[model samples]
Target: MDSAVLSGRSLSRHFSVKGAAAPVEAVRDVTLEVAPGALTALVGPDGAGKTTLLRMAAGLLAPSGGSLSVLGVDVAARPQEVQDRISYMPQRFGLYEDLSVQENMDLYADLHGVPADVRRERFERLLHMTDLARFTSRPAGKLSGGMKQKLGLACTLVRLPELLLLDEPTVGVDPLSRRELWEIVRQLVEQERLSVIVSTSYMDEAERCQQVFVMHQGRLLAAGAPADLRSRAEGLSFTAVPRTGNSARTLQARLLDARDVVVDAVPEGGHVRFIRRPDASDGAVAQLLDGLPVNPVPARLEDGFMMLLRAAPPPPTLPTLPTSPTLPASPALTPPAASKPARAAGPAGGADSMIEVRDLVRKFGDFTAVASTSFSVARGEIFGLLGPNGAGKTTTFRMLCGLLPASSGFLQVAGVNLRHARAQARAKVGYVSQKFALYGNLTVRENLDFFGGAYGLYGQRLEQRTSQVLEEFQLGGQEHMPSGQLPGGFKQRLAMATGLLHEPEVLFLDEPTSGADPLARREFWRRITTLSEQGVTVVVTTHFMEEAEYCDRIVIQDAGKVLAIGTPREVRKQADDAGNMEDAFIRIVEQNRNGGAP
Candidate 1:
């Protein structure tokens, strides 16, 4: 048998909630093994015990039962021995915010007891691999989300180890950066024969691993190669596009409610896909999608996951409340026509010239966050800013929103110079930040009221708008729940609802669906399409290439410069690989990195 770099026998972990009297089972009876030179993925939704399992493997947490061994070292009895041979990076790895990139590397190297000469070579290779040599003197906190993730990975790789544990390494990273990180991992596995176990929510990333383990409510649901699991979903899926409005949410809700007929449903672009139980027949599926349009299609890893979770028997006892609430139901709003685009009022023409940036530049002393770059966004259009992490997308976004002053270049919004009428321009735009910008302590309704009032909404008008948003987002029943208590999907809905409360002409969303499930992402875009029907213009940034399909046009950037700009189809055509945006993005960014024209 292949050597087991890490092995666990019925491992489990229990934690006590601060206010709850009982200790919650974060991980339960998980039996698994990590083989040498293999990439194993631990996947589940948030709070599904992925982190708990990884921590236990790293000897950072003591399992309540079962046995764990790291390269023959018993984790519960000889944690120090296990730690000495493993490199573990938690979700929030200790990347010193105030320290320069090189300084932070040096600190970690010292802590790991790496020799000076060896550390020099390792650090040099890491810097080159992560493409951080150019920003060696930049502070860690100043780095973009993707850059920080890369730096964190680099620091952990400062020393060679038998096992590497990465806890949700690419959770908030952009697609380009995520690809780079995966490339590095692949290279390490080949060159060092490294055994790696990474926890992630992205099925695409998980599919690339040598093996996958699906966890739910702290128990192992399934484990195998991606293809193996996908094969298990055979003859269980079908696709259906909406005839009017956002049909995905309605389809998802309908299928979910029919527990006996359909096991799981996921919404892909333009369609809602489902997976039926093994015992389900074609007629049963037809009965489930009875009133909707449907077509048979192939099953994917996501479909398998949904089916497995849906079919798993519920635990004897109820699981503890998750860190967040479940995603909201889909809205029933109609999507606007795709042909007639809304134009923002501007000097160029009608709403088509809603925003104009001439030689836009933003610099911080000797460093430039955004070099001289220019672009425009039309009203009623979904405009996407695509780039690697720390590639100036946020800087450009900040400048357009008047949140940061540009060192040079002219920026006009709604036919007025942003510099001269910052507040007026802002008033016409809705902005959802990359971070959770809502009040966690306040209920969803309260947060909406606060934002509405800030936008000058009052009394009857505010009440009417709030009710409309609540209904549209399917949050009518949970308006009283604290925003902090909502799940990742619901929180996203609340954020979008708040942004649209003022009914601004242009909406700016920064990575709006980052860290959300595929179903949640599909539903989020559905609402955006609904708003577009009402003539709301949208400018957003995202790490998911699939999400780009929803956009009317996209702008690609790298290192503070524009690389490509066009419709999704047009931009994709520039790729040598044909239709794969992920491949296309990597090719474009890599070419630019090597000083080649996109």
Candidate 2:
């Protein structure tokens, strides 16, 4: 404890709400130790107290019933002393939007009272490390999502504190940027001997840490090296390829529901990876699969985490949202008939191509945001659009949603040509933006009502559809709660519920699971699976490479150009038989950037 950079004992935090029955216990009797000059990770589902513990360590919040020491000093007794030696970056780092990148760094440096001589060297190194050297004069708001995160990290490091505390630093960052950020943190830990404790939702990031603390519902479930933690799931992990004529997600949903035999399940590499109950018979998982062959695979850190979470399950979340397959289709939501574009049928049981894009182009002044990209999405299929930040994924998504006009080429959604009937086409699809674009001030029900009306639903129809979605999305009780005060998972539910009120034939989701925890993400995907099974076409963009397995097919884009498009298996094969989608995606992107060199 004396040598530890930071240590806590029986830490607890509680917050009072105006209408709540009792104070919310954000953290409860948690004990932890973070080693010096090494990376430590805090990981768990949403509302797991990771952020609360980090804030307590940073002296921003006081623990209700425990002691925390930072660098051998008692944080509660002398928070100022601890604050002087540590730098804390919250999930939403305060970057002045109008300030230039260099200006933001300078502001942080000045606030920290960094010596002028030291600031110069530090700024130079950080700029080069973040690859923002050429963008120093660009306004922070003008930078891409990944670049903004990089700038926030650089700003946080302006003074080079002895300890660094980061709360979900890479929440909304793309994979390439996430890798770069980890590299920067690792370099600091190795070269500067700066100790870092970061909270992340990405299991892969936690795997890279020297120590990991798993939390659940305000308590520490386990703490150890990643390997030590992974041992808990040994011999219980397996990968089962779905039988012919079934999608990976369908199998995954089935496995996830069999709580008696399975702990967790997800689609990966065109197969379902699952964790079986230790006490279950060997044939339990096989029987669940209806005699499908199941091969045992090495357990991963994620497998262990899932096991822990299952042992201490959180509140019952949306297992599966109801899909109104029996409801009649609304005439106003029907797509206009248009000339068919010649294309092969897509997987996932779609009868016809619902989305057709050919030589699609979009430009902003002289810069092309999307350059002649082409792809097709089938009705009842889940199609993914993946790319690094600033790679034109959002721009392409906007064009498909009919929110923005394409510069040229053919584009259609739900049989309606986007160019000729943008409004009509918009009515046929539901769109959930990357950010929470709903009115935060409104109650959940109010936001639903407003959006429902905007979609042309009337008095009785609007009320009926709104009520149906509210119940199906498991947002029934939260209808009266202020949307902003809701938890992350609930906010996501509200957003998704709002998008589905009018029951559009096609749904477009842009990074819907960004910053969401494992439980929330699983629930979201389960709902998506149900929707697809009901013949609703789904188009989505995501940074989670594993999620690509859920898609019937995907298109990888970079710098406004399509690098690869195929099923996850085919894409992986193209990248030298990469073990997983993340590896395959990295290899393909790097290869293209390296001029197709192996």
Candidate 3:
């Protein structure tokens, strides 16, 4: 038998909510094993207890019941022993924001008691491997989202631990960074016989693992290779593209409602793909797709997950809140208009230019986050900025939004120079940050109202705008709930609602759908399309390459440079031999990493 690096028997964790009567079972009766040198994935949705299970395996959290052992040490009884042999990266690992990249590495190395000579060698290799040498002196907090993720990974890798436990390390990281992180893992597993247990929400990432464990509501639903889980979904999947007036969102919702027959439904590009319940008959599936263009297709991991979730009855729905008296019944809320001056022409046809950026640069002392990059965003288009973590997408975004001033370059928003007119440029664009930016203590309605007022809206107009936005974003019923108390999906909707409260000509979303479910993503895109119909130009970044298909055009960046730019179809063509976007992305990034043209 293969060596069991870590094993858990009937492991469970419970947390007591401050006000709740009963303890919340974060993880329940979970049993699993991580074999030496094997890549095992713990997959689940938000709050599904993936983190809890990983923590227990890492000896960071003691299980309320059952037992766990790391290597030969009993974690429950010998946590320090397990800690000495394993590297555990919690969901929010402490990365010193004030320290420079090299300083952070040195600090972690010192903490791990790595010898000075060995630490020097390891740090040098890591800096080169992560391509962070150029930014060695830059503060960790000052780095872009992707850069921070890379730094965090680098800090953990300073010491050669026998086991590595990472809890959603790539949650908000970009594709390039994600690929690099995985490559490092693959190499470590092969070279050192390292045992790794990582929790991730991305199915593609999970598919790369040798073994996958599916968890939901603190229970293990399935465990096997990706192929094995996919095989179980055979003969149940069918694909259908949008026809006539039916949108993907409409089709998905309709299919989801048929829960008894259709086990799962997901939107891939322009089509709705689904899996039928095992007990569902052929005729029943046919009936479900009656009048729609449907074809048999292979099943995917996501399809399998949806099938499993639908097969088992759903957990009880949370109780609804009382209606708010402040919100009026009629007309609803209408978001404030854009604060910036309106452009002479609508997005469809501007003076041949929508956003012109020339020789744009953002630098921090000796470190340059974005090194003289240039790009343009067309009017009435969905433009995507793609790259690995720390690729400078966020830096470029901040400069575009006038949140961060460019060190040098000619930057224009809606044909107006931002350096000369910062407020005007900012007013013309709506930005949804990667992090939750809304007031957590404020109700959804209050958050929207505050944002709208910031844009100079007032009185009944502000109230009307808030109502309209709430309804448009599907948060009409949850208006009174505090934004902080909402789930991942609802929180995303609330943030988006606030961003769009003022009708800006351009919408900027930084990983807006990060940590969101497939269903929520589809819904969010539907709203994006609705806004696009009204001629709102969208500039966004996402870790999910599949979501890139929704964009009219995309730009891939690396090492502070634009690598590729084209329509989704065009970019896929660039992959040529690689086939899909995921494959193309890997190919492009690997070539760039190896010092070739991206």
**Between candidates 2 and 3, which one is better according to lDDT?**
2
- The per-model lDDT (C-alpha) reads 0.78, 0.86, 0.76
Give the lowest summed-lDDT range of ten residues in model 3: 327-336
Q: What ordering of candidates by lDDT runs from best to worst? A: 2, 1, 3
Residue 164 displacement in candidate 2 (angstroms): 0.4
TM-score of each: 0.79, 0.92, 0.78
Model 3: per-residue Cα lDDT over 1-598, one tens digit each: 2368877789889876432346778898988877778899888765678877877777778889998888878898988888888888876779999999989999999898999989888888778777899999999987876678778888998998888888888878767667777887787788777888888878877888899898877888899998888787888888877675445545765676686787666655556777778887778877887778788898777777666665654553223355643323324122234343332222223365678888998898887888878777766567788887777887898888888888999989887798889898877788898786988888777888888888777898788777776665556566676777666777887788778776787889999988765545655775675565456778898888877766767788877888777765567677664545667777777777888855
TM-score of 1: 0.79
Which of 2 and 3 is ahead in TM-score?
2
Task: Name the best candidate (by lDDT).
Answer: 2
Which scores better on lDDT, 1 or 3? 1
| Two-way TM-score contest, 1 vs 2, winner | 2
Tell me the number of clashing residue pairs for each predicted model. 5, 0, 13
